[model samples]
Target: MEQSLYLKTAISAVRAAEKIIRRYWDDGFDVRLKADESPVTEADIEAERAIRQVIQEQFPSHGFYGEEMGSIRRDAEYSWLIDPIDGTKSFIRRTPFFSTQVALMKGNQIILGVSNAPLYGEMAWAEKGHGAFMNGHPVRVGKVTTLNNAALSLGNIKTLAQGTGWQGLGKIVSGVNRTRGYGDFCHYHMLAAGQVDLVIESDLNILDVAALSVIVEEAGGVITSLDGRQLGLEAKNVLAAATPELHELAREYLRVN
Candidate 1:
């Protein structure tokens, strides 16, 4: 079945969500924490609502796994993975790290994705069988062959350490060149866009990793769990890289640590 139509809908959802986020961008919103201790604000709710509205209007039969609203039509093979506002804490602080992520998944595979970070004025998108692009220009992963020369992106070392212990986190950290923190799902886009070489994070919702997976893979990278497993709807940990060799090197450590 042709899915180009879904691409248009995915793009629209991201753009609509971007506008919603931009409105709340420096305006003060009541900030609070979710049950999982993650930040949530009005921007997140409005962005998700805007994106969901478009998705429902355009593809009512499609499924959605969203951060704020939970799951709907989830049994469908083709579904959307959405994180309306990825960096809620950053958005709350009026920092420039938050972004909106939308991904289309067919069964276990991600076919297309778009991530818009209004604060950074960037958009990364890709469709399966076609190359990835950034702001309409084709983007490719870097030539960082060796882990020692590769740059890395990570979120919350504290979580990694607490969940897997320092031995696990240390093995993975020491194997890379340098690690920089990026927004929730933006790190994967950076990998696909060649802005970063590697990213590993723990405790992510499906809405956080799904759409970003296609962006990375289309940019010539691999997106998998830290243990080298295939991406899953219920997955919570991820480590993506520009090359499979680097991915395995990191995955090995995380697995046995």
Candidate 2:
């Protein structure tokens, strides 16, 4: 299939998920804990199921790896990654920052990504070579070249401490002009839209970071782990920045070698 086909399919799949999410929004849904202690909701399961139904219909032979449903046809050359609700905590709290995330990976490399903030009425997407866009308008990472002028967004302190530790996070915070805990997929969208200059987080799975990886990269930013390594599904500690120079500077504070 063509690259555009991948992107279109991703968008359609997420929008299908968006419908289910919006239907359950503020209507009261049950939350259950996964084996890892992460929260899961009816919306998460149904939305992922909704996405799978759409994608599988079009590409029956493709693989699927979803947060709720796990994997199907895992050995297929083409795969779909789904995080039905990127911020389920926020979703359960009725916050509009939560999003639906979907991505297409061909042989381990993400080729398309779609992130839909349905409640906020915003959608961001990108293909491998195509540029990133928000609600059909092109977006790019900010031009902040120095940490002194950059606005940094960090993930939850507990998760950050798990990887880089408090001292390392302190070094990163002190070096930046501003810092905010815009946790989850919100900060990644902000980075892609040039609203924020950097974002660092830890303990991410492929479903958490895959879509944002392509979106941020296509927006002319770099997305990777704190160690400055290229991102793959296995990357846990993520560091996304507007420029290579800023990324290296942030890595220095992160103390990742």
lDDT string, candidate 1, 58-165, tens digits: 888889888998889888988888898887877777787777889888887888888888788888888998888888888888877677888988875566677654
lDDT (C-alpha, whole model) for all candidates: 0.79, 0.87
lDDT of 2 by residue, 203-224 (tens): 6777888898999999999998
Best by TM-score: 2
Please list the residue runs of candidate 2 whose C-alpha ends up more than 4 Å from where it truly belongs after superposition.
1-3, 162-165
Error of 1 at 56 (Å): 2.0
- For every candidate, C-alpha RMSD to the true structure in Å: 2.5, 1.9
Best by lDDT: 2
